[model samples]
Target: MPCCPFCSSDMVYPLLNTLRCKRCKNIWKEGEENPGRPAACGSEGTSLRIRKKTDPLETRMKRKLDEYLTRSKGKFCFSAMPWQAGDISQELFMRYLKRCVKDRSLAEEKDRYGRTWYLRP
Candidate 1:
């Protein structure tokens, strides 16, 4: 996830290759000036950015959960969660959701309508 340039919120969800910042409501596509390649810290061509370019499935799912919760404000229908993104499947999403619930980072609720909603802790 990327940090917002203004409010520094990590609410920026990775929508494909784009990052949408929730705090500043800024949509940032990786600028042409700085390509997505990882840069090493140095005196001349230095970058403070610690690029964890590779994230495990769990981290990505957690970010997705946060993004959904932030966007929904409270309760959200289960169908709202993106079922698939490129190679990532809905099964993987559910797996991580269950893991999140196990870790207490997220909770699940059932509405009067009997629909399930994933929530933040």
Candidate 2:
């Protein structure tokens, strides 16, 4: 799947002949050579600022999780997890955590208080 050039989100869908990014709601023509730059608008030929492509959400999440784990000595609960504000939700984070555990990249355990903690394997 092609990631959105604006938000680096994979949640994009085709709308007519163009593709629309669900995360940032930006629309661009499919197969465009430079998706990072918006098409020119009006007679003046003004266009939105071009954005540099960024890592996909999954990769970014992994990096943030790794940073937090390192800072916390390799163990952390969901409530204490660090992620960019408004970038993700608890449910999404849990889903990613599940994938990580399944991939054996991370380990999870329940403490006496029934709180789940995640750590690097």
- Give the winner by TM-score: 2
Q: Summarize candidate 1's per-residue lDDT along 1-121 as a digit string, tens digits.
A: 4465434566766676666655444455543345444432122342223223355545666677676677789555666654435323566567778887798877888878787888775
Q: Which residue pairs in candidate 1 collide?
A: none
Q: RMSD in angstroms, candidate 2?
A: 7.4
Q: What is the TM-score of each candidate against the true structure?
A: 0.48, 0.55
Clash total of candidate 2 = 0
Each candidate: RMSD:
11.1, 7.4
Lowest-sum lDDT 10-residue window in model 2: 41-50
How well is each residue in 1-121 modelled by candidate 2, as lDDT tens digits? 4566666677977779776777665666654455355544231332333334377667767877887788889899866655555454556667788999999989999988898899887
